[model samples]
Target chain A: MGLQQPSFSLTALAAVGLATAMLCAASTPAEAVPSFARQTGLACEACHTVFPELTPFGRRFKLNAFTLTTKQEISDINERKQGTLSLADLPPLALMFEASSTWQGKRVPDSNPSAPAGSQAQNGTVEFPQQLSLFYGGKIADHFGALFQVTYSQPSDHFTIDNSDIRYADQSQSGDFLYGLTLNNNPTVQDVWNSTPAWGLPSMTPPVGLAPAASPLIGKLGAQVAGAGVYGMYKDVFYLEGTVYHAALTGKTTPIDSTSGSHLDNYMPYWRAAYERQWGRHSAELGTYGTHAHFNQGGLNPENGLVMGADTFTDVAVDGQYQYIGENHIATAQASWTHENQTWQGLLNAGGTSNSKDNLNQYKVTGSYYYNRTYGGNVTYTRLSGSTDALLYPVGTSANGSPNSQWETFEVDYLPFLNTKVLLQYTLYQKFNGGSNAYDGVTNRKASDNNLVMLGLWTNF
Target chain B: MKKVFLAAVGLATVLAHAASAATESPPKLAREVCSKCHGPEGISQSPLFPRLAGQQAEYLDQQLHQFRDRSRGDPHAQAYMWGVAGPLTDAQIKSISEYYASRKPVHGAAPSDPALAAKGKEIFFNGLEARNVPACAGCHGEQAEGQGAIPRLAGQHADYLYRQLRDFRSELRENETMHANVQSMTDDDAAALTEYLASQ
Candidate 1:
């Protein structure tokens, strides 16, 4: 089953009626409550500039372990009431549903050229209800909390676990030092900022037929690994974290692919460092993160010597973010770049990849502005490029042999209720699979033909 | 391609104008909408109105929502905030709270009786076991800057605090926990406590 794509867009419109929104609750949760607001007894404004876009307080809330509570509690009395403990008092449970429609610039030709008469996708398709989700989000104990989500995608007709980040964190101050620990399941999922690949924009998007074909390895390890790390914020200025991740069984009971092995040969190391400062109305952050991983060439079969060997991949990323918050307006800018080095020795031995080594790169930047917290808009541009290997991508023309792609996204959002949002988004493609025109070569499909428009309603009770 | 870029730029310009027109500073909103009763910069001219300056933003936001939802039904709340909060959008509520939180606070007038003020300080820092009243500083900070969702109690108007304590004890205010805590306190106790907090 395919996972629900995090469709990142601006906030929704507010003037829409609740009854009308509920009737149109044909969509899934974008910024659902999931007990965080209720547990903290604060509104969304406390944590987000807009939904999923964190404010300074929101970042602190995450780093402090999501343990702040307003419910009745029983404290654990050690020598000095050491760590506060409260009941899972409030049911940390919530549900979300969504309905959506996609309008493409041109009709999608048949997937199989041999069967041109076969059914083809039209220019516009309406999903009665696109997605549904259940969330268990909030504090698990005094120093531990988790945001666990399970989603059901209507188009894929399947259920799967979605984005989840469980953390064990606690802070202690030694004059200028404040430090904490986090044990999580995903690489960038524990991050407080949206500039990270895992939680970054398009908070929600179509699960199929919309994204680019290639991405850095940093974007590929969400549900397939577990990690633990320690972080510290020095005088609330410099931040650092170092973690190691190991492969976890993915795809439920699906058999492991013997050729393109999905299991890891050894632990992957990830690290992040950043400097942040906030002065009055403005805040800015500049940071870098990187990871090194080695995966088995073939399936991790105990008896197979060839399968025991490994292929290595190393990924490095740098990112920055800035925000200016005012009573009447909020403005933000974010950018990130990722580069991946792939050594395909193991894969080539297993007869998987075409080359021994390949390099890939991804770059993205977005700017957003919100007026009166009621109306807002954003623009994003992204580019992806990689080393050329004909055997690796022999599907199309000479341009398609190169892994170069680019996309542009524009969105506007309106919020009538702080907790409710309506959005209209448009996306454009400059290049797809290395070609701006005749991308697929055989079907005569152009990258521009894939332009899409979407309207969505997102809310939580 | 050029046309699309130009069109996007045009849309952005229009949207930016809309943003500039739609937005207003929180301080401006506070002065125009809240200052009539709470006083300029949240220092109240009337004892009946609570001092709002330097109050916790979280507390103000919560109270505003409560008032809007009619969960806070004190006589004054019903008479004043019910109407004020009814028409406020969430952003307005946040702006108003943040504005007040950032405002400079002014101390209320000292009580005429020093002995009463001293007694109030005792109650403020130390709980009275005989009455099951917890120390005010246990939850509110020593100087009452507030933490998390708790409200700041320092340097507030004595009359307003006294009235609230009395209201809580008399069931005129609807806070279940606060009412229970104040139930056994006498009028003198309420008076002394308010004076002590105001002195801070």
Candidate 2:
């Protein structure tokens, strides 16, 4: 046997579907699902404005998406003789969904003996999906199409619609020159990376010095929607995008001035640019993203001896990826380094309230292999650290931001079925400083690790 | 010299034709084995059963592999498909996938109603922006011809579209990309987009 087909359990198909999406999925795109697009040998834009997002064509692909192998052929839209709309070329409203459930290895200590009594669970259990979504991908117009979708889960009732966007694209026969726009709503950087997505620093384990889940640094809710962005591709190689949006609700910001209750409320402007080049089986990209904001918060915390201050953080990253594409084998490795910084450390006293400014550095690497039906798997590792220690506010009052030495993670994906998969993973973290998660006395800080067992379903729709 | 070149070209054309004939769907696997449930030539008439004819080769390979590996969740179909899809090796999947994709789809008729088609087109081109509805043609294409991973939407089933849009708006579906787009859309947009897409 070349490789045992690895398939994970599919529990809580609703809740886990989203977790998998946050971890394994990359970038928010509007179009047919990635696996489906990959199967069709069609560029994502053929049906989507972005990856994992859908357009009209993307929606059609979903209707009858799963039964491709059984199909006879793709009818040419132009060849249809009698109908105003070519029935021969229409796609279906088929779809693919996945979910998984994970069991965490770490134990929850009994801080209060009288707390809600529960099982001292040791063996981890996970219920979520590798791909759980209800989608419609296909053509909606003579030329335009889309992927419309929504996902239902626990913790919230009303179904949340996402990954929906519209697109109009054009490409020459030679496959050069692609132009289009995507009208959509997506989370900001903070919201997009909320928690330690399997893709980001492990949310399972908090960094050294900082409290993991305990920190006020929870991921932001998605914002910055209701806008149109332009995307262009030259020679089917170089690519670019530009967009703008206003936040729905004014962000809750840190105090920026000593004056009680006086703050700056303004619409933040964000811009991101990236360049990618592929060589052989590898591709490399360099990118920079920036956002400028004038914050305004409530009155100063005079009781806590606090003053408001204006701040901004600009981030930049360098990334690279390589793919080993063979007739029967496929493998890929990708890595990136990101740096972030803010202004204002100088105004506040050393390790004082004004010292909230920070500079951080992060790095990640992941690899995946798909060897024809015999076997397939993927593994990824990431780390994040700080150039200068972050400051403490509400808690850990006198503590200084420690260098984030422990944002480490490891994950493994097993494809037991031909195209289906189950992934299991674990992560370790340490926050050696006195910020967020750390709150031991004045500098509440310590090292923490998390063992997560994830089992879920992954498939091509 | 020119006459000789023309003769050579003619010979090459004949040879190419021979090559085409030599490449055929695996003889053992025919419509008899697959069409019984999937419908003639792998296309389906039932709304629930997806049409399979005319899908791309890679797509077929990927799905077959997913099912065989058990990475996808479908216990309902597993009882029926497990044995058949499992025994096939990678090489077999590739060939079968190629053979099926190479076949063309049997044509069908367009919807008889023109009013729905016209209304759907309006939504496709110019969305209700005041209501924050975005146009569909902005990204997919003026003609709905997709590129790089996007699916083709020109022609599809109306019931399928309607079912999906409702699923999305109602949260029965949890899609990351389209979920947000649907969050603000009214039921009308979903209906309009569905009707338009199905008509396409």
Best by lDDT: 1
Kindly state the fnat score of candidate 1.
0.00
Candidate 1 at B24: error in angstroms? 40
What TM-score do all the candidates reach, one by one?
A: 0.65, 0.47
Q: Report the Cα lDDT for residue A429, model 1.
A: 89
For every candidate, the chain B TM-score is 0.83, 0.57
- Give the range where candidate 2 chain A is weakest over 10 consecutive residues by summed lDDT: A1-10
lDDT of 2 by residue, A215-234 (tens): 11111213323334444544
TM-score between candidate 2 and the true structure: 0.47
> Candidate 1's C-alpha lDDT?
0.68
Task: Give the alpha carbon lDDT tens digit for every residue of A1-461 in model 1.
Answer: 11111111101111111112112212222444547876665566656888778877678677767765545554565777565566665677877666667787776544433444534555676665576778887888876787887877775577777667777654321113345567666788778777887767766564334445456766667666777666766545788777777766556443445543455555787888999887545789999998988866444343574454676878899999998876568999999999989887665654445688988899999999999778997888999898876544444322345668899889888989766667888889899767888764455667887688888776665
Candidate 2, RMSD to the unseen true structure: 23.4
Which ranges in model 2 have alpha carbons more than 4 Å from their true place?
A1-96, A109-125, A128-132, A172-174, A187-226, A249-274, A278-290, A293-311, A344-353, A387-400, A403-405, A416-419, A430-448, B1-200
Fnat of all models, as shown: 0.00, 0.00
DockQ of 1: 0.02
Query: Candidates' DockQ values?
Result: 0.02, 0.01
Per-residue accuracy of model 1 over B2-62 as CA lDDT, tens digit each: 4433443453344334334423244544643465446556776445568898899999999
